[model samples]
Target: MNYYECMQESINYIENKIYEEIDLNEAADRAFMSLSNYYRLFFAIVGCNVKEYIRLRRIHLAAQELLSNDCSILDTAVKYGFTSADSFSRAFKKATGLLPSIFRKQDRQYMFERVDIMEKYFEIQDLELSEKYPDIKVLKETAPFYGAAFRAESKTPENDAFIGLKAWFDKNEIGNIMPDYRVYGYDIPNSAKDDGTYGYEVVVTIPDDFQVRGEGVVKKHFEGGLYAVTETTVGEIVKAWQRFISWLDISRYEMGAHQCLEEHEVESGFLNRNFEEPENIRINLYMPVVKRNQTEYGKVIVDPVRVAYYREYGSDSEQTAHNVWKVMLNWAEKNKLDCSKCKIYMYNHGFAKVKDFWFEIMITLDFAFQDNLIKEKIFKGGKYLTYDTSLSQLVSSWMKVNQYVSANKIASGNHQWVEVWKLNNWRFPEKGIMIMYPLV
Candidate 1:
């Protein structure tokens, strides 16, 4: 069989064994290739590894089962190799952005589409080296990364152009540095890339207390922020990069001064596993961003209120806010520290520049928490300007607030701005938000 046919045969085998534990070696044998050859070919064509592909297929089928049969979440999770309901829910939500319960309720397409293996091959072969637009996503702050940095140069294509970093890791015995096997590709700015070949730091995350002791190794912290993320494979990376830049043209955001981050084999499951080559690697591209246009949406006034607050440092404002409120609301129910008024105070002005991000998620408290970390603070009433926005429009809306402040000649007060989640649902706020900024 040809390459495509062999791949399709292997795909058929996977489909047949969707519920069962799939052995990679057996799949490779079915494809009539060694494990390495099968992995390389499949990743090249499918843009994911063997395990990832299986997860996608299994989840896709599980979605179908959830829709068609009267299956419980736990039963479905057990059937699909998920450990628990929470794990299944998290994985499902990560993939489809909806919980299995909600996903089952929605009447939508759930089946996995069969790949046209030959068609994709021909498309890639016929694809010219030209601009290819990427589907960009505005991601909220991500998990922090503490890793080592080094300058690297490309040498051999067969060895994935990562031989330099690999050599460095070996010489330094980097296994002693961190037990984790994940490797990240950090883009170095203004570095040499004369011919579409650039330098990057192939770094791995270390513990917070880990000390660095080596030549040319620098400890760097990627203070996560709002990022414009897109996926690109090694083959079309150059074109994909150009396309990402092009997307920024029409995008609501512009690039920031931060270096781009690429996710390679930077997860636990992927450690120690070698790909056929770096060219076969699929990477998610992350570019820091700022507002492109600052338009004033105008502002309104705020009122004084006593609130019970939970202060979380270095948290993603988007995701963490919801969880914080959920916990706080539950606490209020138990403690009777209840009031109808609830609003989140953003102290760091992450809406303007999201670095070293911190949040003070608060709910109305008649009495304060005696705990030092979670205490009550009175929002001194003041004349405030209001700008409306949502998580998606946060950056732009903040820019609008800035424009309003400049044009109206209003000085902001020392009081922290309040983000009002007025919607009945915090997870998906269809009506957006109101930011009440205290004026001087």
Candidate 2:
């Protein structure tokens, strides 16, 4: 077995016996390694000694038990292998910065969830690409990836490439692991032969320590970098590539040093499930690109508010967005709205074409204005990473935000991307806007 699978098995064993007296030697035996090797691998992969991981995991799980059940502190400590209540409290407070008593009363997020070896070392957050919205491109950066590349030459490049990857995994008895990894590929840049065929390489993510062996497969490493990504299905992929080329032609960023990739991975968290698949699997096309100019953007936090909004659907031109603001301000004027006390924010949405888009112009409403006539929604005030920049700097600012999100491992929630004008200074408002992305 590969080291990752062995480490995973040992982690599983430790988790199953978390409540019992865990033997470090026994854990080593489970991984088929010596005690020293086990400790080394565990520390290298999990980033903590097994004992520390167990203690924190106990505190994390105990925090849950303290809130849900009426178990005494001493009983909880005994259940999780702590010798006494005092020992448990010290370890818990040291890890969570709160006493067990206080932690039970307060609700907040914790970082001591059980460690999954595969996810910790190999997983990356994929930018959930929109298959239909050809205009809304997402900027993403992948870490240096080690993959098993399966080369294929065929008239049907996509199908042949995927087949080779799956067959290799199944033959090697690792097909079950495919769901936990990513599959990406690219057509040979300039290798179209006269036989009406092309070369495509399918890449499967592998652990850095895992060595691969197969007839037509080889281990390859990529120096991952920034990519402007979009999604399309098997039938419409040709158009997707065209869209990328067209975007780069006018965009501030040009293509970069790496090959463009088409990747597929399962998407998690809040999203439109309808766009996921209809037996027509989706593909995220990534174009490696570099910025032509350098600029710095400031980061800040934005508070949420209840807002009444007017949505306008129009072309992708700036004039359409301006018209949305005009319609919103006209309605607010008719209603005698107080702009000084409230803020206005706009959220743009993409459609099937770059020329078609939709935007919502919103005004924060007070408790007294709740009864007024307009569509109202409460924005769950949460943490956000934001920047103050002009409309022309929108793409670069969002790229900065994307970098922050990925670095911080922030999870995304239902779409609430907001760009607002300066406070009550609405003159030629497009000149200045605060671009904000919600963080969860």
Candidate 3:
């Protein structure tokens, strides 16, 4: 069978024997490869070693048993292949950030599942590129570059940009487009081109001593940032981009700001289309990336919710919100308020730094039961960006969402970001905090 099929078979073996000791050598035999080769292929395809995958799967199964109240924690641990309850608890805490006991009693449930290598491999749309997949590298930064940038800011900029730059080369008989000039290309980020327009910039790095010759080529410095880079042959470079993007989606990183680059290193013979032995040339693709937030979130539309609220200004939002929550609870108890939702909205004053921020604590209330003890208002719901996260590092998740809004150029419908407190937890997320930001 093929390599992917073999890996799937080994995964099947792992799942079947998770409650028992799995021989690494036996797993390799199932894949029809040496143990070392099997390990290599598994890591490349599954993004983790085979042993770690099995451990995670076992821990996941163990969690279910603990939550079901069907087995004691020690019994669950031993059944899932841990030698002792202590060993199991340590493993569980390392993988899931909580002890088995704490996790079982926690209000919010954690999401974990077995990896399906076969299905994941088959789903890659650019799987054809696997025949010659380029070796990828995650770079913290690239060297500073000063270059003359040629622009194609139009409705179809990608193709137009290349054509425009190529035409410039042809017009001047500029042999400089070759590797000697260090040429690069990228999609211009966040430009106002969504109105039936696109934007791309092609640049060739130039030395300080080099004389300028091209017309309408603007020269500038491009300070680089984090990038996932790969080198592919000229014939495969374009399609390689699609494959690279797919890789990033599953990886720990997400798209970030700045230029996503295609740096060309052409053979000396490359000028027009017909170059001698063209296969010798290569293109290095650079996809800007940032560490992804582990929080699960998406776009949602919320209907208007009516709530009774208390507003205050505080620098420490969480502590301040906690205090306001106590007051809100007292008010609700006094009024015998029936609530549908509990929410908090914190507003920014449109400044870089502020000593204090305005926050409102509220809960959805029955309109029929009027209460004069607090201010009642209808939260005019619209399209929003929302996420579900645990209390641990909750502030980082907020920072991530804000960064996402900025990186993606998201248009905000309002200045305040809403925190959705207390969910049902029976579904994807029932009893955890969900944060929502207004999106236009």
Candidate 4:
């Protein structure tokens, strides 16, 4: 079988055995490939090892059951081929951080419940894309928007929330325009929800002086900007996100801090109407991008020991690290860290490989923190490193520094500090924290 056919077969096997046993050898046989080749190809195409992928899929399924049914943890675990509750807890914790009991408890709060549908839909679809946009002309215009929005979980394109949007527009006597009129959907994180409903704002643009009724909040603004927009039919939302990612990769354009907007086009008669057919709906996805800044000349080299300091803050639990970074930056500035000669970098832990997820934050200071204030902090035994590096090479240099520290078995004692001093525009005098090793 070809690669795509083999993959499809394996996927079918996984789906059928989801509530029972999974055999790697059986999957390989079904794919008509050797075990080694299956393992390698699976990882290459899926971005995850086969075993890990199986576990992720199982966890996703268990989460859905927890939300949709009244099954106990043990029952769900057993039904899904888990040997015991403890084993299931460990796997669940690794995938979502919350234990089964905690997840059950939060079900009423609708946290897990709201995401269940999205999770299921995500499992059955391939959202990644190789390209985002072909050559398209750019257009700029200001638009007016009016609509009522509430946060609710939706997996299918056809949902009550979307239907409600159409109803609201019709009730307010708003008409749609070609190409410009669309629905802006925003995803808000770190917020509380009731019955799986969180806070969401939706805006639908209208013509001049068209005011929406119903005491719902309304706003108007200019939407003119460099937007990388793409269109997809009703069933192609997943592909659209992939296209946006591809566009970003090829164009080297950085995303600004803003919520993306989606414009939906439906038949004119469908206003405040429910339709069962998918072909009647269309969607346009827009992502905003801005130009990147060019690097300045003269860079510094940071010591490996100090790079480790930033690495530790990449953890999910490092709350105080951001404050520490601010203090270090202030010290460097007061001490005459040379902006021209040095580089400054911030790293976040838990970056998403496929979707939007990231871990902790890491900061690397090059020559910019060399003044007297920084020296005082070092003399006081503050936990930081002073390195010499230009800003442009900070990420790669830090990776190398990490490699060196790991190879040499260098210890970062209790302080665990890394930072860079800004001096003359030249990269030099990189310092790393020294640690004592435990005696065997």
For TM-score, the strongest prediction is 2
Measured against the true structure, the TM-scores of the candidates, in listed sequence, are 0.36, 0.39, 0.33, 0.33
Q: Candidate order by lDDT, highest to lowest?
A: 2, 3, 1, 4
lDDT of each: 0.61, 0.66, 0.64, 0.47
1-440: candidate 4 lDDT, tens digit per residue: 22334555886786778777889899877866567656755654455677887787788878878888788999988877889999998998888878988887787322222112112211121123312233221222223234335333333323544555666666655542322344555433322222343333456655556544554445545334445556565566677666655455445343422345555543321343335665535455666544333211122332442321222222212234445455555544555655564444333321122122222223334432333323312211333323334433343234333333443455544532333334333323333222111111
Estimate, for each residue in 19-67, the C-alpha lDDT of model 2 and write its tens digit: 8988888898897666755675576557787778888888888888888
Give the backbone clash total of model 1: 5
Model 3 pairs whose backbones collide = 423-430, 424-430, 425-430
Model 4's number of clashes is 33
The best candidate by lDDT is: 2
Cα lDDT of candidate 1 equals 0.61
Q: lDDT at 91 for candidate 4?
A: 91
Off by over 4 Å in 4: 1-137, 140-158, 176-201, 207-223, 268-280, 294-440
Regions of model 3 farther than 4 Å from truth: 1-134, 153-180, 188-199, 208-214, 233-239, 268-270, 274-281, 292-440
Instruction: Select the stronger candidate by lDDT from 1 and 4.
Output: 1
lDDT of 1 by residue, 1-440 (tens): 43445677888888888888888898988876668657866775566777888887778988888888989999999999899999999988877778999998885565556565645442221122223332555554455667765655342222342454565567767655654334567543222232344345666666777676666667777665566666666566678667766666555555543446665633211334355544655566666665555434455666778876776543234355555566655665667532334454544335233333345666655554575446777777677777666754454455445544654477879866667655342333445677777787
**Ranking of all predicted structures according to TM-score, beginning with the best and ending with the worst:** 2, 1, 3, 4
**Per-residue accuracy of model 3 over 1-440 as CA lDDT, tens digit each:** 44455677888888888889999999988976567556755775577778788888888878777787757888888888888999999999999899988888893355567666545543232433444443555665456667767887666664565556666666754543322355677654323222555456877666655455666566677656666667666567667777766666456666654556776542221233233344445556776666676435698888887877887666443456566666766776676544344444433332233345445666776655555556888877788898776543244456556656765678889634677766332122335677788888
Q: In angstroms, how far off is 167's CA in candidate 1?
A: 3.0
